[model samples]
Target: MKKTAQIFAGIRTPFYYYDMEILENTARQVKELAEKYRIDVHYATKANEDARIVSLLSEVGFGVDCVSGDEVKLALGCGVPVSKIMFAGVGKSDEEIFEAGIAGIGAINVESVQELYIVNAIAAKYGFVANVCVRVNPNIDAHTFRYVTSGLNTNKFGVSESEFPELVEMLAQCNNVKFRGLHFHIASQIKDIAKVTKTLCGVANRAVEWFAGHGFETEIINLGGGLGVNYENPYGDTFPDFEGWFKAIDENIVRKPGMTIHVEPGRALVAQCGDLITKVLFVKETEVKSFVVVDAGMNNLVRPAFYGAFHLIENLSAEERPSLPSNRVYDVVGPVCESSDTFGKGRQLPLTVRGDLMVVHSAGAYGQAMSMRYTLRPIAQVVYSDRINEAEKETPIL
Candidate 1:
């Protein structure tokens, strides 16, 4: 294992620091494991939009899965092969579909039959035959955050079972469209093996029956990424047990001849190696509650504000304590004006003061990608372990 300090223990706070060495290890593990079963894996770019990160992933022999036009462009611009890109999203506009179709992408994962019509029309306008997948709402509860729960029957993400008859009729009308397969994405942060297995079995059974009636075999079965990580111990558990994750599903599901299995992983692959480093601006203590106000806020990382998500907050400056660092609990807040801007409430940590350094673990995947410029707190630099020495001169935190 690579030493954390040697790579990048601290050079800046209020900015995202990524351990490239850890990511390198993670990519190797994921690729080697998935290759064992001949599974085609696509790294979802929605989790982290950094072009350099995408480039590294491209170098590691992986495909790209995008949700928007810009994300598709980012993946391609960063060197992902056009033949290996798949587009996904529910609200894709005419322009977004137009752009992806024109890019000569591998396929577009169409969420609704309405989307199939739009994408096919766009491809027709471009004089091209586009490959696409119909996203099926299997209605399997992913047991994740409500906001991220998409496969539920009422969610607005995919085509419902009730719409199957129309979908089959529409597939017959696709003269300029190729219905390549079916896709399903349940939710995020799911770690239970049985839950995923049940979902896989359910999709396989449904699709097999759907195909028998319609004479359209599922060429690809895509189970979108919702794999969870150990945010509290990012370094120790950066890699997921793909053998269990993939094997469980593989054993449970029956694939058609020459069927391709695609997985679009974002957080599970990239979350652990990232940290949001910030400097304590003020340590305010009140009779009612204590707060650790920092330069970072919802603007820098919104997981806390958006989902009431939990991330491990640590005092890097207090590393040398004889025992564990200060165990006192306080609200780790930012400089935002909104009451929802706080990162965490009653967050216990080392006793801290102004200028002390704080490291918020697992800020990599959704952290920087979701940052905003609210209140104009200057955007922090993204430090990668591979180039930390270069960023140090330019992004040295006080």
Candidate 2:
């Protein structure tokens, strides 16, 4: 990124920079591995949803995993096939369900028995059978953040084991809803393979057998994506363990004849390829600590404020001034009014100063996608690596 900093110097501050080559390579890796394991991959559109990123992944033959009607439309607009789109969300509105039924996407992951009835009713009203998958809450702990854990009984995501009988009865009665298979997503940012191979796989197998006993044959096991990326050291292994993840599923999952396995990965595919570039606006020194304030704020990248997440931060202009101390501890903060607008605390970097370029790594997944106009801040512009020179010529320096 130091080499790229030269190009960034001429552009405006607080913008998202995406490395399309890295995204392409990561997409290719996922495609090759999915093919090797004969697993269908649907890129979770909620991760980034940038037109360039989505279009590239679509061209790579990866389907889309949508959670909203707008997201489904966005994926379709990005050239993703309607047959390749899978819609999953707990609170899908009636309009959304009607749209999905009309569009005839691959499958709609139903989270509750009541939702199954609703989907069936909507499909019946539209005179088309909606392909549906029951999202089961296996109650497995993925050991991730509390907000991201979705498989627990307490969470409001999927159907619990107690609802199996009701779900089976409902599926039997719903003529307009075609039972495709099952869906299980324990949590997001799952780094442990045991969570998938041992915990999730075991529950899914039992659920499939239970459903089959009740006259529903499982066709697709959509393992919702939670594969984690290396946020601590993204530069080391930029890619997530797609190979290991697929291998584990291939070995552990008990696939029935003519049944297909599917995965919906979001962060693992796009996180490493992007960075949030911000220029230090002030270097404030207090009695006990030092702070490096940047123009970017929680509205720009909310992971730090929302999830208490970490992204590797670096001073890209450090090498230019060798006279400065190599080790300097300071709190990296944003200019937002809220006290939670901090990026990192007690971070060690080369003596940072005003005008120094700072890069936040592993932000491609949730950074720009989750950004808002909170505090009335203008949304940051995106600059792709392949078009850096063009962006530099177009964007005037602040």
Candidate 3:
């Protein structure tokens, strides 16, 4: 911890610090475990679209799972093979669909029958056959936050099972569209292994039989990744139980011969490899409580304000000065004008002061990707730990 603080003392505050080594290790483990089951893992581009991160994953041979046209272009720009890209989104624009069709990417997960028609039209215009996967809403409760849950019937994602007949008829009518497989994503941040596996098995089994009965042979079944990471204790569970999760899926999902399983993992792969570093500006004590104001705001890392998310906070300076009494509680907050800019309330830490550095763990995934310019706060710069060692100059906190 002391060495970590020393490393950050030279770095600018309110910047994203990524440990590339950890990222590579996590990817390697996930890749190994996924290969053990012969499953294809696609790194969801929405998580952390940092060029270095994207380039590294592409070089490592992980498929890119894109949610938008820009993300598709980012993967392509990062040199990810078109055959290793899978595009999925609810409200894809006509232009986006046309772009995907023209790129001749691996597969596009069609959300609705209308989207199927649109994609087919674009593909026919280009004189190409567009391979598509049907994103089905299994309607299973992912038992996660409502904001992150995506598989419910009420959610604006995936085509429901009730629309299967219509979807089949629409596919049959579209000559330029080829049905490749089915995609099911219950939600994000799913922790209950049994719950997700059970729901997925039931859905995959029915989907296989449904396709078979319709005289369509399914080649791939994409079980969209929702495996949660340890936010409360990122270090303790930096790398999620990928082996266990894969084993559970293997034991549960009955697969047909030559069928391939694909997973789109976003948060699980990158969440633990990064931290949000900020500097304390003031420690204000009021009649009700004490607030440790930091330079980073909700615009920098909004999980706390957006989803009431909890991240492990560490006082780096306090750790260095071990002589200070450690029994102090403060509300770690940001300088955003919004009242909800608080990161954590009643956070107990060693006695801290202004100029001290604070580290917010488990911010690698959505932290920088969701940043905003609200309040005109500067967007945090991202620095890789591996590169910091090469540059010896101190970076002033902006």
RMSD of each: 2.4, 1.5, 1.8
Worst 10 residues of 1 by lDDT: 1-10
TM-score of every model versus the real structure? 0.93, 0.97, 0.96
In candidate 2, position 387 carries an lDDT of 86
For each of the candidates, give the backbone clash count: 5, 0, 0
User: How far in Å is the alpha carbon of 361 misplaced in model 1?
Assistant: 0.3
Scored by lDDT, model 1 comes in at 0.81
lDDT (Cα atoms) of all candidates against the true structure: 0.81, 0.90, 0.88
Model 2 Cα lDDT, one tens digit per residue, 1-398: 33445777867778999999899998998899899999999999899989999999999999999999999999989989998999999999999999988889899999999999999999998799999999988999888899999888889999998999999999999999999999988889987955455678888989999999999999999888999888999889789888888988888889999999999999999999999999899999999999999999999999999999999999989877879898999999999998899999999999998888999999999999999999799788899988876664334455
| lDDT assessment of candidate 3 | 0.88
Write the candidate numbers in order of decreasing TM-score.
2, 3, 1
> Which of candidates 1 and 2 is the stronger one according to lDDT?
2
Steric clash pairs (candidate 1)? 13-277, 13-278, 14-277, 14-278, 326-350
